[model samples]
Target: DAGITQSPRYKITETGRQVTLMCHQTWSHSYMFWYRQDLGHGLRLIYYSAAADITDKGEVPDGYVVSRSKTENFPLTLESATRSQTSVYFCASSTSGRLGYFGPGTRLTVT
Candidate 1:
């Protein structure tokens, strides 16, 4: 997979539960990002991992967490889901400094 891919392209979970979205890439890029898109807010970063075991919170990481144990896989977890957390989540990978290849995305709905 030269490009990025996401699992569970769509999801529906109850509030206060935990959910994880998976992402994988074959480029072995140095950067991986997780973003959620809403109606009013555009793509808002939830977290980003630079390399294995090197992750950082992004614009909106309140209820989300991310880890990069391997360069090819970056998974995002929603610790405690809420109605407000429902959105379309996108996973992307890129080299040090270049355009990122985005995954198809995983739409999560919290009810």
Candidate 2:
């Protein structure tokens, strides 16, 4: 439960402003990912990284950016926050791409 925790638990930003959500995992799983949870949409992958410096786009990558410079850290950034981007974001880590351990989740609101 405490293996991963996201910062700023909640945030509110204006449209066109930039925002970044930070995720840190103490377990150091090889694969880390960013996902957004919204009403009706469920959870959608925004991006994922297999290892340090190796990242790939996921189901929804537009308007978002991610970087993994270290195995335990993966940060997701919104290039320009939009109303549609407001949602609860989660960070998860997995060793083999199957089961994953998730963070506490960060609630982001863009007005």
Candidate 3:
């Protein structure tokens, strides 16, 4: 309730369907990041926002979209979900981008 949290802890969606995963933080950190964890990739950054209206693409931003309208909210959307996108997604927040606090995570499976 006081830290970071993710909604819909688990999700199952069909290919080509649109899905949105929500991340909310109460700490009001300046930097928020979205990462996808896979077998070989470990933890890959999908997108990150330095501020409310300033966002940037990360290492693997191909199939994912992220937006930060408020300091406490950073939501990631899959415009057209794909099977290859199935992974455990984590939302993290940090003040200096060195050490971050992560949310519980959302496990998404695209079928």
Candidate 4:
């Protein structure tokens, strides 16, 4: 079965602008999370949603926001992109207490 998918596998941009990354999944997992992977930061949670319209701030939610209005979609938006924000973003979904399935991943670079 089709799993999660993320758009713009690679991106480049100048610092300070809005950027929204799209994530979609075919499996109706109830928990979706957004995380950024960095060289030293490992995987930092940016945001997550337990279900539609129910999101909570993660460990590193600053400058980032996410919403899950549909059970199969969770989108992440950077209010103002920055160079420090450049990192590999991943979208993951899972059933409660189960292993998460990750998307292909999106690499964003800001100058």
Candidate 5:
């Protein structure tokens, strides 16, 4: 889903070193997504999953990973952290192809 292509791209929320951000939605939406927000680049898609155990790569999936094992939970993991990976991550869910809701962002900064 090339969803909500034009929303506020600024970050809302941080982690240093190996970090994992978790997102949980009570609405039981089938689609979940992960994005990273940076000052100049805005929000870049990192990964998304249509359902539990189903996932896909997005624009900037490199160095990032995601998993969905339950309908309400989506977790993002950053491997071998690098300074370039520093950014605020956002998690979102939607029933249709467009994004409907966004979780509070989690910041990750690799030193």
Candidate 6:
């Protein structure tokens, strides 16, 4: 089974456009997270959900949105993509406070 996966491993879009990154996992973990990795910022949590329909904004939730309607899928959308938003996005899942399993990230570039 694919533990976790992210679609459109690489994406390029113009500034002000809308971009959606898809993430899926086979495990039905109780928690799921979305994070972005940049050169100096390292990894910053963008959003997280404890269960279906139960989501919370993370450290950097501005300009982005997330939803978890199912235990296995969490999708992230950028309302208006910007150059500064270009980064590698990772999706992770875990049980309660357990260690999370991260998916292969999606590298996004906005011009």
Estimate, for each residue in 1-111, the C-alpha lDDT of model 2 and write its tens digit.
449889989999999999999999988799999999999999999999999999999999999998898999999999999999999999999899468999989999999
Model 2 spans with C-alpha error above 4 angstroms: none
Evaluate model 3: give its TM-score: 0.96
Mark the regions of model 6 whose C-alpha exceeds 4 Å error after superposition: none
lDDT (0 to 1) per candidate: 0.93, 0.93, 0.95, 0.93, 0.76, 0.95
Q: Write the per-residue lDDT of candidate 6 for residues 20-62, one digit (tens) a residue.
A: 9999999899899999999889899999999999999999999
Q: How many residue pairs clash per model?
A: 0, 0, 0, 0, 2, 0
1-111: candidate 5 lDDT, tens digit per residue: 323231233422233456567788778789989988899998899999999999999999988888888988888877657778878888889998665788767765555
lDDT, candidate 1, 1-111, per-residue tens: 378999999999999999999999999899999999999899999899888889999999998888888989999999999999999999999887698889999999999
- Residues 11-103 of candidate 4 have per-residue lDDT tens digits of 898788899999999999999999999997899988999999999999999999888889999999988999999899999999998899999
lDDT of 5: 0.76
Better of 5 and 6 by TM-score: 6
Model 3, residue 75: distance off in Å is 0.4
**Per-residue alpha-carbon lDDT of candidate 3 for residues 22-106, written as tens digits (9 for 90 to 100):** 9999998999999999997899999999999899999999988888889999999999999999999999999993688999999
**For every model shown, what is its TM-score relative to the native structure?**
0.96, 0.95, 0.96, 0.96, 0.80, 0.97
For model 4 the TM-score comes to 0.96
RMSD of 5: 6.2
